[model samples]
Target: MAKPMRRLMNPALFICDLQEKFRPAIYEYPKVIATTQKMLKACKILNIPVFATTQNKSRLGETCEELGLDSPDGISTKVHADKTAFSMWTPEVRKAFADLPPTTPPTAKRECIIVGIESHICVTQTTLDLLREGHKVYVLADGVSSCNREEVPIALARLRAEGAVVTTSESWMYECMGDAGIQEFKEIAKLVKETKDSTQQSLQTLCKI
Candidate 1:
């Protein structure tokens, strides 16, 4: 296996097309949002950079409220990029990276942690593009979904075959934590606890395929 990512301090998170209108079609919408929320909280504690994309927000509506992706001030650690493109590697997203704090190296790019809706389309395209650009992509399977249940498994299988590391939100968070001694361990532990019940019910369905 490849050496696992332990770069939580400056990690990058890509949340794609998790809009309100997109919810009805997504399987296990509640659990996906719950797991994603847990992941986001962990990212905040670790100061992981976040880039969120909304596909045609005019029609799809904004990102769902459960995730707290909206901050009216247009100022927050979570950067929002509005786009019509399927691949979120749009200019806005690129600019988000460019706008990262000086703590981030201008030369080297870290692995991108990906999550969000419609696994077979935008999520898949973005994952492939990032991989093509030599960025290791880790897609959080439990946090990704498709309107057509069958398509998710197919897309995930293809993503894995293409060398994208497929994993669950919990596993990735624990990997990032690396130890129980970290001060943030308590918050992360609580977040993990809250999500386990509902998340497991959905993961059973998502992972079985």
Candidate 2:
């Protein structure tokens, strides 16, 4: 008898409108950035491609420099775009998505992990659009926020209802890694340890009601 084929995950990171201008307005914005930084570091270790967007960069400013979206060694940025639309799923991003190598054996759908600002708007729309495109979406609870903290939970609940998996950054990282035996496990483990304090603080601040 033939053995069943192993499933594979082709995942990408989506950073939505975590720009400089909104840092002062978004609730717990620092915590959001901290969580996103952790994810970006993990993505670098795991070799996952990253796509980032800014909402009208002319007015909103660029994605926070601290995330290092432009640094080749910091994050594997496939497309860093500026958009007027609420969704990060713009034409440029779509084209970049199309250009990615197909999943091995072509059977697994891509998985998108999102982290960013204004959970009720850009993040929510991005999640919905990705779901519509037949991709599995995971929105990091600790990596998303809004001007009003109240909006965060509501947006998360709606996305969860809409089929997106609402999970924390650490949980999603492990889920993506899937095994301690993988080659990147040691590095990831170290990252988790190094960011322990910050992670806990971020969770408490960003996930609190």
Candidate 3:
């Protein structure tokens, strides 16, 4: 068994195409999006870098409004990548991530935690490409979804075969920060509580109807 201690996660988060058009088709989009938002908040509080991609925003619309992404000017726009491909290698994609300063030491490439829709398409391709680039790729299993549940498991199997670390949103978040006693812990704890409360409320509503 792989030691849980060895399952270190990346501080950088790469949110893929969780757009409005894309979410309704994915089985766990609501849950995944909620977790992704929490993970994003944790990263932000810890001063970790974050990157996101969208698949042709003109066609699909923006990343789901729930993400609360801020513009470069900090206006909080839902649109991010506006790209054609699944991988963040397009001119637009490259420009967005290229400017982010690494969170770790100067020599270390940024670690990327990827979460998004259609595990077999955008999520799968992006994770593979990042792994190829020598960056640590941590796939947030609970935060990625597909229209078909089977596809997600298959994609995860392939990723594990290729040595990608598969993890959950909560696990990855705590690991990235490494401890809950630091001053920042209280801040992240608040975000985590907010996420849990919101998720429970959403689930309760879904059950009521």
Please provide, for model 2 over 45-125, each residue's C-alpha lDDT reduced to its tens digit, 9 standing for 90 to 100.
877899999999999898888998877556658999999999999999999988999885497689899999789999999
- What's model 1's lDDT at 207? 69
Clashes of each: 0, 0, 0
**CA RMSD per model (angstroms):** 4.0, 2.5, 5.8
Please identify model 3 stretches exceeding 4 Å from their true place. 1-10, 71-79, 197-209
Estimate, for each residue in 118-208, the C-alpha lDDT of model 1 and write its tens digit: 8999999999989988777999888888888888889999999998999998888887777777777788888888777867876887767
Report, for every candidate in turn, its global Cα lDDT versus the true structure: 0.80, 0.89, 0.70
For candidate 3, list the clashing residue pairs, or say none.
none
The candidate scoring highest on lDDT is 2
Task: Give each model a TM-score.
Answer: 0.87, 0.94, 0.81
**lDDT agreement of model 2 with the native:** 0.89
Sorting all predicted structures by TM-score, with the top scorer first, yields 2, 1, 3
lDDT of 1 at 149: 81
Q: Find the candidate with the highest TM-score and give its number.
A: 2
Candidate 2: list runs displaced more than 4 Å: 1-8
Model 1 reaches what TM-score against the true structure?
A: 0.87
